[model samples]
Every structure is written in structure tokens, then in C-alpha cells.
Target: MTNPSTLPDFDHPPGTDLWVFAYGSLMWNPGFPFVEKREGLLRGYHRGFCIYSHQHRGTPERPGAVLGLDRGGACRGMVFRVEAAAVPDVLRYLWQREMAYRVYIPRRLRVRTDQGDVRALTFTADPAHSQYCGRLGLDGTASLIRQGVGQSGRNVDYLSSLIDHLAELGIEDQGLRELAARI
Candidate 1:
């Protein structure tokens, strides 16, 4: 993967807004300011517990799993509208937070929203990355979550929060729900 530092800055023209696609933690804690938000759908990708987190959620010795936009299916998420002037700072922050080890590939993905279809900045799982754990069975996933704890908090907390947020949105993720129950 290319260095995130070398990626283009997410700058918007004077009158344009920066739309961001949030499929994971960003849905609950964006950290940056956004003017508007709406339920959105991103096609050609589905949220999966595919990344082996060795920092924020666990250690290298016993990595925790985190969500990633894996290819196939569709993902129902939130799209945030960021002010143009804040794009630079927000992009910087996102790079630092999400690209600690370049486990994701930054891209402009088409998101379907009430406002219409628009391209938004999205971070997708890098399947070739060392941290990519790919597909895991519910029991295995739960086992990892049960043993994971990192700088941020427990892995179960992360999985539970995502499941809870999806429930609040009326979106069902059966696999995750099953795993959550096992944990």
C-alpha cells in the first residue's frame, strides 16, 4: 500500500462539502465536526470483522478483530457532510487514526443516500495486509473478542457497540449478532 502521507488531501472547493462514509467506529465517534448526516448505503462492499487489530484493540500476541469493508454484498452506514474548510484537518486526523499501519485502502466510493448518490471518502480493508484476518467463524471470532484488549478498550466492547448501533439503525447483521451472543 502507498504511504498515507502521500495521498492527496481531501480538500473541497469553496462551495463544496466533504462527504465521508462511516461504516465502523466513525458512525459512533467521528471525532471531527460534520454539518449533516444520513443513513446511507455503499454497494460492492460489506462490513466484516476482518482486520486483526494489534494496537487500538489488541496486541500482536493476541490480536483483536475489527470491522472492514470487505468486497461483496452491501453495507448500510452513515454519511457525514463535513465543512470544506475543515477537510484538511479532518483528513489529517483520519490518516493518523486509520493509517497507523496502512491496513486499509482509502478510496472514493459511491454512497446512496436520501440526498442522492455521491462519492464519499471510504476506508476499505486491505486483504493483502498483514493484519487482514479475512473470514472467521462465529465461534472463532467470539473467542478472539473474548481475549482481546488494547489501548482503546476491550474487543467485545467494540463488537457490542457496533451491533448495538446497527440495531438502533434497524440494520441486521446476523453474523455479527451471532458472534456478539457467543461473546
Candidate 2:
């Protein structure tokens, strides 16, 4: 559970090439410039409904379930390669977007793509953070997810979108399926 500010910018030269991993909303809405995209497999981390969304998907009074890259297992997600010219701006956009709640700890992980393995920037859960609700069981998770409605619309919609995107990529998440079914 590290703070993003303490780390370097992927240790790359200013305005250089970089890769970013997207497992949740980012996969559908990166909100940044990128030249290449691929379905990459990230090991040593698993996606879970660990974060409580207070704005994007729900309000403080009724937080929504959101995905977080937790320790152990693996996750199949999308990876984007930002060109050198777009690196700085993309990084800035990413930092602002993903770090709003400071609930995620960004890390550089090796993602296995069809082209090859790439060291991409990934946002993992900060277990020590206040927003970290961890595994709240399937029924409990579905409850929060169903009751949530915020600026981004319904929390159920977000889960549906994620499930759709994952399905399009031929990725199967049993936990996600059970949660989705419960909701």
C-alpha cells in the first residue's frame, strides 16, 4: 500500500513511451491519448470489489462497489501504449483520474501481451486506505452495487459494462459472474 507521489514516472525519460494497464472503468474510458491497445494478462494481482466509490458511481451516503487490483492471482485487462509525445499529458490525466480518492497505489507491473511482456503502470488497492472495504461477500457487494447511483449513473451499469468488456475480451471472472447474478 504505497502512495503514488513517492514513485517516479515509470522511471522513463520526460515525454517518452509508456504502457498503462486498465482492468475496470479505465478499460472502457481511459480519458487519455493512446496509440496502441491490447488484451494483457497481469499476474500477482486479482480484481475485486475492494474500493467504495463515493463520487463516480455513488455518493458518500451510499457508496458503490468498485474493482481494485488486490494481491495474488491474476487479471486479464486492457493495456495501452502511450506515444512519447502524449506521455506527459496522459500520465497527468491518469494521475488525476485514478488518484482522486487516493485509494489506489500505482505500480509498475509486467503484463503479458500477445506482442510481448510490457512493464505497464497499474493501480492496485491500498489496503490501508480508509475506502478499502475489502471482500464484503457476494450478497453484500450486490446490495451496495444495486443501491448506488451517482454522477456516472447507476452502479449496476458500471458492473454490467465491466462484465461486457471482459466478455468481449474472452475473460471469465467467476466472482464477477456470481456478483452480477446476485445483483
Clashing pairs in 2: none
Q: What lDDT score is found at residue 128 in candidate 2?
A: 91
lDDT of 2 at 81: 93
Compose the digit string of candidate 2's lDDT tens values, residues 136-173. Answer: 77788898899988898899998888888888878898
- Candidate 2, residue 34: how far the Cα is off, in Å: 1.9
RMSD (CA, Å), each prediction: 2.9, 3.0
Q: After superposition, which runs of candidate 2 have C-alpha atoms over 4 Å from their true positions?
A: 1-10, 13-15
- Give the TM-score of each candidate: 0.87, 0.88
lDDT of each: 0.83, 0.85
Query: Least accurate stretch of 10 residues (summed lDDT) in model 1?
Result: 2-11
Q: Write model 1 residue lDDT over 1-183, tens digit each, in one string.
A: 333446644333545678899988788799999999988999999888888988778898988988889998999999999887887777778888887778888888889998899789899998889888776666777778898899999999988888888888778887687777888
Candidate 1 residue-wise lDDT at 41:
97
Worst 10 residues of 2 by lDDT: 1-10
Clash counts for all predictions: 0, 0
